[model samples]
Target: MRILEVEHLSAWYPSGRTRRQVLEDVSFTLDRGQVLGLVGESGCGKTTLARAILGLHRACAGVVRHAFPRPQMVFQDPYGSLNPAHTLLWTLEEPLRAIGTGRKERRDRAMELLDRVGLGPEYAGRYPQELSGGQRQRAAIAAAVIARPALVVADEPVSALDVTVQRQILDLLAELKRDDSLSYLFISHDLNVVYQICDRILVMDKGRIVEENDTDTLFAAPKHPFTKKLLEAAE
Candidate 1:
C-alpha cells in the first residue's frame, strides 16, 4: 500500500520580501516498508521536502496524502531536538500523553522502547544532557517509533554523529525496517550513507529530482549529469 504520496509539491520561504522557492514540483510515493532515500547537495531541498511532508512548513502548491495512521519524524539533531530540562522519561512520556495512552501503559511501554533502542531502562530517568550523542539519537528514534506510526521521515538523522555512531544508527534503522515493516523517507546529502540503507533513491538538484532509480541501478549506471556528478563527488 502507498503509505505516503506527494505530487507537484513546492515549498517556498520569504527572504526579506522575496519569496524564494526551495522545493519545486517535487513528487514521490512511499510504499509500506520501503526506504526512499532523498539525496542531493546542501541546498537541494532535501530537508525542505521533509518539512513539507511533516506539515512543519506549508507547501506552496501540490498534494501530500499520508494514508491514515499518520507519520512521525526522527530529527537529525539529538541534542537540539530534545530539551535539557526534561528527563528522558518525561521526554518519552510526552508522545504517550499526547496520544492519550494510559499512565501505566505509558510507563510500561517506555521501558520496552528504551531497550528496543539499545538504551538501558535506567537511562530513562536521566536528562538528555546525561547521554552521549549516539545514545541521544537512539533515544530520539525510539521516541519517534514508540507510537508505531506507519511512516518515518528521517532528515539527516546521523549527519551530526561520528562515523561509528552513524553506523550504529544505520544498523538500528535497518533492524527496525526488518522488524516492524516501517516505511522511511530518508533524506541526506551523503550518497554513501544513503546507498547503504536505501532500497530506492531520488537524486535532487536545485529543488528538483534530476534523476531516480533503484539503489543498485543508480549506483551502477547513473544516467543524469547531476547524478553522475553526485557519484563522482562521493568517490
Candidate 2:
C-alpha cells in the first residue's frame, strides 16, 4: 500500500532580493514497509524535501499525502534533537502524554520503546549526556517510534557515528522495519549506506530529483551523470 505521496512539491526561502527556490516540483511515493533513500550533495535540497514532507518547512506548491499517523523525524544530531534537560524516559513519554495516555501507561510505554530501540529500561533514567553517541541516537529513535508512526523521515541519522556504531544503528533500523513493517524516507549522502538499507533510491540535484530506480538496478547501472559520479566516489 502507498503510505506517502508527494506531488509536485516546491519550497523556497527568502533571499535578499527575491525568493530562492530550495525544492522545485519534487514528487515521490513511499509504500508500506519500503525504504526510499534520498541521496545528494549537501546543498541539493534532500533535507529540505524531508522538512517539506514533515511540514517543518513551508511548501510553496504541490501536495503531500500520507495514509498513516503523523510522520516522525529522526535528525542527524541526536544530542541536538533531544531536550538536554529531559531524561530519556521523559522524552519517550512526552508523545504518549500529548495523546492523553494514562500516567502509568506512559511509563510502561516508555520502557517498551526503549527496549524496542535496543536500549535497556535503566537507560531511560539517564540524560542525553550520559549516553554515547550511538546510545543517544537509540534514544532518539525510540522516541521517534514510540507512537508507531507510519512513516519516518530519517535525515542522516547515523552520519555522526563511528563505522562500527553506524552498522549497529543500521541493523537496529532494519530490525524495526521487519518487526513493525515501517516505511522510511531515509536521507543520506552515502550511497553505500543507502544501498545497504534502502530498497529504492532517489538522486537529487539543485532541488529536483534527477534520477530514481531500485537499489540493485541503480547500483549496477546508474543512468544519470550525477548518479554515476556518486557511484564512482563510493568506489
Candidate 3:
C-alpha cells in the first residue's frame, strides 16, 4: 500500500535577487515498508527533496501526502546532529518523553534500544563525546526509531564511517526495517551501498529525477547518462 505520495514537488533558493531552482517538479510514491534509495551527486537536490518531505524546508510548492506515523531523520553526522551535553540514553528517551511516555518506561525503552543498537549498559550514561563515531551513529539510529516511526529519512547515514563500520550500520538498518516494518527514504551518493539495501533506486541529475527502476534493472542497464556515470564512478 502507498504510504507517501509526493506530487509535482518543487523548491527554490534565493539567488542574489532572483530565485534558483533546486528541485524541479519531482514526484514519487513510497509504499509501506519500502526502502527507496535516492542517489545523486552533490547539489542534485536530493537533500532538498528529503527536507521538504520532512516539513523541514520552506520555499517549496506542491503536495506531500503520507499515511503513516511521523517521519524521523538519521543525519550524516551524529556528532553534529546529537546534543553533546545529553547522554545517549537521554537522547534516545527524548522522543518517547515528548509524547508523554512515563519516566520509567522511557528509561526502560532507552536501555532496550541501547542494547538493540549493540550498545551496552555502560554506554548509556556517557555523553555523545565519549562514544566513537560508529557508536554515536548507532545511538542516532536508535533515537530515530524510538518513537516507532513508520518512515525515516536517512541522509548519508554512513558516509563518515570506516568501511567496516559502514557495513555494520547498513546491516543494522536492514534488520531494523525487517523488525519494525519501516520504510526509508535513504539518500546517498554511494551506489554500491544503495544496491545492497534498497529495493528500488531513483537517480537525480541537475535537480530532476533522471532515472528510476528496480535495483537490479537500474544497475544492469542504466538508461540515463548521468546514472551511467554514477555507476561507473562507484565501480
Task: Give all TM-scores, in the order shown.
Answer: 0.97, 0.97, 0.98
Clashing pairs in 1: none
The count of backbone overlaps in candidate 2 is 0
lDDT of 1 by residue, 15-126 (tens): 8878999999988888999999999999888888998888889747899999966588988888887789998888888888998999999998889889888997889889
Error of 3 at 151 (Å): 0.4
RMSD of each: 1.1, 1.0, 0.9
- Inter-residue clash pairs, candidate 3: none
How many Å off is the CA of 166 in candidate 1?
0.7
- Clashes (backbone N, CA, C under 3 Å), per candidate, total 0, 0, 0
lDDT (Cα atoms) of all candidates against the true structure:
0.90, 0.92, 0.92
Task: Provide the global lDDT of candidate 3 against the true structure.
Answer: 0.92
Model 2 ranges off by over 4 Å: none
Task: Please give the distance, in angstroms, between residue 228's alpha carbon in candidate 3 and its true position after superposition.
Answer: 1.3
Task: List residue ranges in candidate 1 displaced over 4 A.
Answer: none
Off by over 4 Å in 3: none
